[model samples]
Target: MLRIMLRHISLLILTLFILSFFSFSLAYLFPGDPLVNLTGIRDSSEQTYALLAQQYAMNDSLFSQYWHYVNNLFSGNWGLSFSSGLPLAEEISRSLAASVELSAYALIISFVIGLPLGFLSGLRHHKFIDYSLLSASVIGYSIPVFWAALIAILLFSVQLGWFPLSGRISLLYDIPYDTGFILIDILLSDVPDKEFAFQDALRHLVLPSVSIAIVTSTIVLRITRRSVVEVMNSEYIQAAYARGLSPRQVFVRHGIKNALIPILPLLVMQFTTLLTNAMIVETIFSWPGIGNGLIQAIYQRDFPAIRAGMLAVSALVLTFTITSDMVIQIFDPARRRPEDATS
Candidate 1:
């Protein structure tokens, strides 16, 4: 078991190393010089441009640049943004809490809504409940995230005025940016006037979060339903049923557990997809998460911010995949020694 875990960790590290290398390489190979782009008023003479590139060490060998970037990454120094004149690390640090909170809420909402529906659909295959759930999943998955977000805004924010249209909080409130997490900051602050600010922040999060959650939940629900049905037809499940076990007991004890073991990996991969989808939703809703931050950084041509944001997201996805693998190994101990378990 320990050996298997070590091998998994090694593979995870190797995968992340390759990801970081390629990401850095692409940034290096992008069109236009960062120095020239930043200066904006510089002459286009070859010698002057060459001198500027050399000054910023862009003229260094590709291998040297990659090594230096990797080294800076290790030392917790992500460098400065060419446009913002702020440290890349600081900018990400300021915005990260909000993104993390949003992502967490989105994931939680997805699982809370997806898992039970999936299980019920699988258990009641061919019934109205199953058909309705399957149909909803298809529609949910097929809709474009931005379109859904815009529609949601039109319905909830425009026509009904049920939720705020933009921003993380209301303008009338004097909520301090205590931790960049509007809800947490509001709760932690002693300001009496901003007591209701937390609820306002949560209300603002609802539309964008639901837009993201719908897509995320659909994927999980479909996967879970498929996995559960597959597990239900397995020999072990049949044997449990033949032994006169209750349907509920067979499902809860045998079917769902084994079904979830396979679904874990898919859920992990979905995190990155969800985050990528959230980028558009965040912009549409004017939410100040990493997705919106990345778009703004690109518009400003801030290389450091762009690189750091991508790297941070890459790390998050990698972490989720690794954690899922570990959980799978724990739940399905037979995978540790497949031959022995099969015999």
Candidate 2:
């Protein structure tokens, strides 16, 4: 286990190093001037321009500039976005909470909606209910994110007025940004109508989260059904059934546990993807998340912010990949060869 973990850590460091270098390289390869973009000022005086350039080590060679940028990155001076004229590090930090909250909510929604449905569909396997559930999942998977988000906002926000049009909470509540997450910050503060404030945050969260959840859940539903079906057909499951155990008892005692072994990695993968795949929903919903920030950075070609966002995403994926692998190996002891300890 130690050997494997060490290998994963080394690989993670190497991957991040490579990603940082390539993402940093985008600044030089892309069109337009990096110095002007960094400062966000198109018409600075000659002296101010010179001073800004010197400050950012823009006069350095490619290697020197990257080294300087990385040094500053470690020190938290992640530079400024040309679009918003805001510190990239601070923007990323702010966006991180919103993105995390949305992703966590989306994952919760997906699992709550998908897992049971998938389990039921699997047990019924070729029956009407199973087929119907499968069909619904297919439809959910096929819906385009941007289109779904727009339709949701129009119907839920405009016509029904059921949910807020955009933003994390209603403007009426003046909840302090204690933790950047509206719900958490609300709880952490002595705000009036605390329950109401929490509910409003949930209301604002539901539209985008549900929109993303639908697609993710569909995948979860299909994969889980397959896993359950496979596990149900196993010899031990059949033996349990033959021993006069109730179907529910057999499922609870043996089937579901085995079925979950394969699904854990899928759940982790889906959760990791939620962190980055939420860009369109965030943009449409006006959620101030990393996804939204990345989109703005892209439009203005804010290279540093774009690079930072990519690194964040890449790191999320890589970390999750390792986590999934470790979790699987831990859950299924068969993968952990006993001889490895001796070697």
- TM-scores of the candidates in the order shown: 0.82, 0.91
Off by over 4 Å in 1: 37-61, 173-180, 231-265, 334-343
> For each candidate, what is the lDDT?
0.79, 0.84
lDDT of 1 by residue, 261-293 (tens): 788767766766777777778888878777888
- CA shift of 277, model 2, Å: 3.0
Per-prediction CA RMSD (Å): 3.8, 2.4
**lDDT tens readout by residue for model 2, 238-264:** 999999999889999998889998786
Name the lDDT of candidate 1. 0.79
- Superposition-based RMSD of candidate 2 using all C-alpha atoms, in angstroms: 2.4
Residue 316 of model 1, lDDT score: 73
Q: Kindly provide the TM-score of model 2 when superposed on the true structure, using C-alpha atoms.
A: 0.91
Error of 1 at 79 (Å): 2.7
